[model samples]
Target: MILDALFFLIQAGLTLFFWAILIAAILSLLTGFGILDTRNRFVWALSDFFYRVTEPAMRPVRNRLPNFGNVDLSPLVVMLLVQACMLLVGAIRGYMIRGGLYF
Candidate 1:
């Protein structure tokens, strides 16, 4: 019972994390390449919000990574981490089920 609830919470968090990383990466690519202009107020606001929200996770990675020409790899790293977390949660759930620890 408790394990099922915990698994649900973890799954939800990981799903959101994956989506946030994906959106941030797409936004970063569009903005970086000028495909997405922040000229419009709505675009600017959305970009700003995403930047603020994702930067804390990305900045450290950005600092540590070497630039690959015009490409930014921090968001890729973030996405990978999110996927890894989801996989980890899945593995935990599997283990619990196999052991009959989750009801």
Candidate 2:
């Protein structure tokens, strides 16, 4: 029971982080293209929130990846990595269920 609950929580967190990274990427693009004005308090706040939430996860990926000029691929890499982790957790949970190992 405890293991199942732990897995659920992990999956939920990964999913939330995945969406956050996606949103942050979109917001960044909009701001870069001038479609969204950072001068607007709401826009700025939202952007800042996403940046704070996503930056820690993205920083390592960013550091390892070679820069592509203005294009940032760290979010894409982070999303993929997070999805991979979610898959791994799900697989482990499924295995535990099938093997009756969740005691």
Candidate 3:
């Protein structure tokens, strides 16, 4: 029961983080294309929030990657890594549910 709850919690956290990254990526593209102007107060606030939420996870990835002038691939890399983590968590939960270690 507790293991199931833990898995649920892990899944919830991953889902939230996944949405955050997706939003940040879309925001970056919109702002890049001038569709979302940051000068508006509300837009600015939301943009700042997204940056703060994503930067902690993204900055390290960005630092390790080569600087690509006028382009950033860190978000894509982060998304892929997050997906990998989700798979890992699901695999662990599956293993636990499948009778655990028997022997």
The prediction achieving the highest lDDT against the true structure is 2
Candidate 2 residue lDDT tens string, 36-83: 999999999999999999999999999999979999999989999999
Ranking by lDDT: 2, 3, 1
For residue 75, give model 2's deviation from the true position in Å.
0.7
Q: After superposition, how far is residue 86 of candidate 2 from its true place, in Å?
A: 0.6
- Model 2 spans with C-alpha error above 4 angstroms: none
Clashing pairs for model 2 are none
lDDT by residue (tens digit), candidate 1, 1-103? 7877888998997787678777877877888888888898988888888788888888999999997987888888888887888898899889988998878
* Pairs clashing within candidate 1: none
Q: Per-residue lDDT tens digits of candidate 3, residues 1-103?
A: 7777778898888888888989988898899899999999998898889899999999999999999996989888998888999999998777866876522
**What is candidate 3's local distance difference test score?**
0.87
Residue 83's lDDT within candidate 1 is: 85
State candidate 2's TM-score: 0.93
Model 3: residues with Cα > 4 Å off, grouped in runs: 101-103
Residue 15, model 3: lDDT of 82
TM-score comparison, 1 vs 3, better candidate: 3
Clash pairs, candidate 3, are: none
Candidate 1 ranges beyond 4 A from true positions = none
